[model samples]
Target: MAAAAADEADDSWMIAQEWMVWWDRPSWYVTIVNTRIDSIHRRKREENEENERVEGERREKKRAGTRGEQGEGESRRTTGDRATWRRQVKRRR
Candidate 1:
């Protein structure tokens, strides 16, 4: 049991030394910082894309509202007034 305990302790010490050597490397710190920066940039890009998608949907709804509920090639102003329709078209322009 004593010999087994000694072997375990030796193995742990070797692992600790290897960890210390890795931690002392400059590339380890640079890699950590670069990873964090990349994560931040990716998150911001996703947020911007989601915002743009929502804005596009809002604009489409606004256009549809202005056009009324009429189908394609159908006039929304069904009052048969030609002068009124012309005035409406001019206002839109």
Candidate 2:
């Protein structure tokens, strides 16, 4: 793109004074600047869409036990559990 711009500037410019650059002129520079800004905007929109998709997946995983399973704790024993442990310990001794 710069090459094309340089070629166009070279063909159109007629420098009568020394050390003058027509490619640096606002008319030519703004076109390149606008093209770059359009590219940045496109990239930002793609990133935003990707982020939203990933966030939704994460939310679903948490709800369905794929991420963090809810109520997944060890069970508490009833009062009668002591009789079982006592019988086992007595056999071992």
Please report the candidate that would top TM-score against the real structure.
Answer: 1
Q: How many backbone clashes does every candidate have? A: 0, 0
Candidate 1 stretches with Cα past 4 Å from truth are 1-25, 70-93
lDDT over C-alpha atoms for residue 48 of model 2: 97
Q: Model 1's lDDT to the true fold?
A: 0.79
TM-score, every prediction: 0.47, 0.42
Compose the digit string of candidate 1's lDDT tens values, residues 1-93.
Answer: 999999999999999998898778799786997899999999999999999999897766655544664455444444445567788899999
RMSD of each: 16.0, 17.2
> Model 2: residues >4 Å from true position, as ranges?
1-24, 66-93
For residues 13-93, write the lDDT of model 2, one tens digit per residue.
655222255445677686887899999999999999999999897766544443234434422433355467778899999
- Cα deviation in Å at residue 35, candidate 1? 0.5
